[model samples]
Target chain A: MSQVLVVTSGKGGVGKTTTTAALGAAIAVTGQTVVVVDFDVGLRNLDLVMGAERRVVYDLINVVQGIAKLPQALIRDKRIDTLSLLPASQTRDKDALTDDGVARVIKELRAKFDWVICDSPAGIERGATLAMRYADAAIIVTNPEVSSVRDSDRIVGLLDSKTKKAELGERIEKHILITRFDAARAARGEMLNIKDVLDILSLPLLGIIPESEEVLRASNLGTPVTLNDPTSAPARAYCDAACRLLGQDLPMVIPNDRKSIFEKLLGRRAA
Target chain B: MSVLGLFRLRGTAPVARERLHILLSHERSNRGRPDLLAILRDEILAVVAKHVSVDHDQVHVTMDRGQIVSRLEINVELQHPANGPIAAEREKAAMTIVHQASR
Candidate 1:
């Protein structure tokens, strides 16, 4: 069976959708068949992020409602042959998805693909819960802030209670992906540090994506940073995260600009 | 003075000390732990009262580090009317409140 990974965050605009796209592209590049499913429903931003917005004929709701088949709804990525996207509906009908229908679709996807990556909507609501209901594992994306971390805690609680694994008494592996990490801000005590976020979330770190202009630039161009600029810092971080997801032991690097001024001043004073 | 001593002195100076005090206070108040503890205490009291009489004064709910662990010492007190036969029923409610608060 394929591994179903849900990219979720209780707070919005924390790179859950971007992480889903980047990780999906990265995993697909490894010769594995990967499908990135957008469960954002009305917002439907993942297709644009994946540069498949123009190719979206049928969406996730159509597939679930039996109006369209999986193959019809799945849009193959033009850049990467192995990667595909199942876009979300533009309609605002919240009741479009049924529980049993979603389960069946996930089961079918599991049989067909190596990795089924679901991009969950923001907040701990029905859209978010249903996206994660069938997940075998989760990437809990969070920003380096108290509100985002606190919201992530709520999502973690939901993952423990609402997932199929949780209902069946099986363990669903969860990893924390801290995105938009500004080392300079962290050094200046403006944003939460990686260590502080880890101490609060207590989940194993999957990746630390630094706040970079590359992410915004790539998103504007309808491409994931990992694919748009593979050599960029954010791209490298996402690649490392993908490797970690495959159970590789990659050494963690403390993003560069996190050196504290106190330490620097002390060193200078000593010298 | 040694460089380390000077650093320590700087760290403990009035300006740094004031900054530390203000920052610590802000962090603590913004943590939202107290609000969560209050909610937990209310929920616990509601559930416990369904089984036995609980001493409200003895209800202790506190957060340590970032986890919410509550202790409720319920002193069951039964009072019978003078005109009726004194009877007490023993019932155990199987409700466990496991609260793990984190941020």
Candidate 2:
């Protein structure tokens, strides 16, 4: 069965859609058949972020509502052959998504793909809950702030109680992905540190995406940061996260100029 | 020396005290036990009323950060019916009553 991963955060503008596109692209680069689905409904940003907005003729609602078949709704990426996108409907109402219809679509996608990633909408509403209903694992995207962390705590509670795996007494693996991290601000005590966030949330750290202009640029260009600028800080961090998701033993690194210098020195020493 | 005087003299670490206060407040407003004080007050009133005439409105019960348990304070005006007139006893009871209720 395909691993269903939901990229979700309780608070908005915490980089869920961005992370979904970047991670989906990164995973697809490994030649795995991956389809990133947008469950954000009316506010469909994933298709635009993935640079496939024009290609979206039939969307998730179309497939779920039986207006379009799954193959007809799946938008193949021009850049990556292994990657495809199931875009959200811009015209459909959020209430149009029925649980049974969603379940059938997810079941169908799972059988056909290696990785089925769903980009969840923000907040602990029906849209978010449905996106996570059938998830085997979750990427709990959070920002280093009090409100975001509190909202994420509520999301964690829902994940424990509302998921199918949880209902069946099976544990759903959850990882904390802290995005928009500013190291300098954190050092100045402006934002919560990594240790403090981990202490509060008590979930294993996935990877941190630093606040970078590259992310905004990638979004504007309708491409994932990992694909737009593979060597950039945010892209590298996302790629590392994708690798970790694939069960690789990747060393966690703090993205900073000092760390980069240290890496270079260590490389020279080894050479 | 008074117990409170000793606490003041010791000058308990402010950071620890602040953390304790914050944690206590958080626990009080915690999702699991937001109405803990009210529950405790009701239970205490029920228990105390069985033994003596407790002025339920005048009863004071509170939970503070420094204390491990809830504290209950009650001020009662004892009425010796055999030694005094009913009117005098009632007047004394009314005068002895404190206005401040539970925290």
TM-score of each: 0.71, 0.73
The best candidate in terms of lDDT: 2
Question: What's the lDDT for candidate 1?
Answer: 0.80
In angstroms, give how far residue A249 of model 1 lies from its true place. Answer: 0.5
* CAPRI classification of candidate 1: incorrect
Per-model lDDT: 0.80, 0.81
Candidate 1 stretches with Cα past 4 Å from truth are A254-271, B1-103
In candidate 2 the C-alpha lDDT for residue A215 amounts to 90
What is candidate 2's lDDT per residue for A30-137, written digit by digit as tens?
999999999999999999999988888999999998999999999999999999999998987789888898899999999989999999999878789889999999
Which ranges in model 2 have alpha carbons more than 4 Å from their true place? A256-271, B1-103
Scored by TM against the true chain B, the candidates give 0.35, 0.35
Interface Cα RMSD for all candidates? 8.6, 8.8
lDDT of 1 at B38: 53
Q: What tens digits encode model 1's per-residue C-alpha lDDT throughout A160-212?
A: 88988999999889999999888766775556778777766689999999987
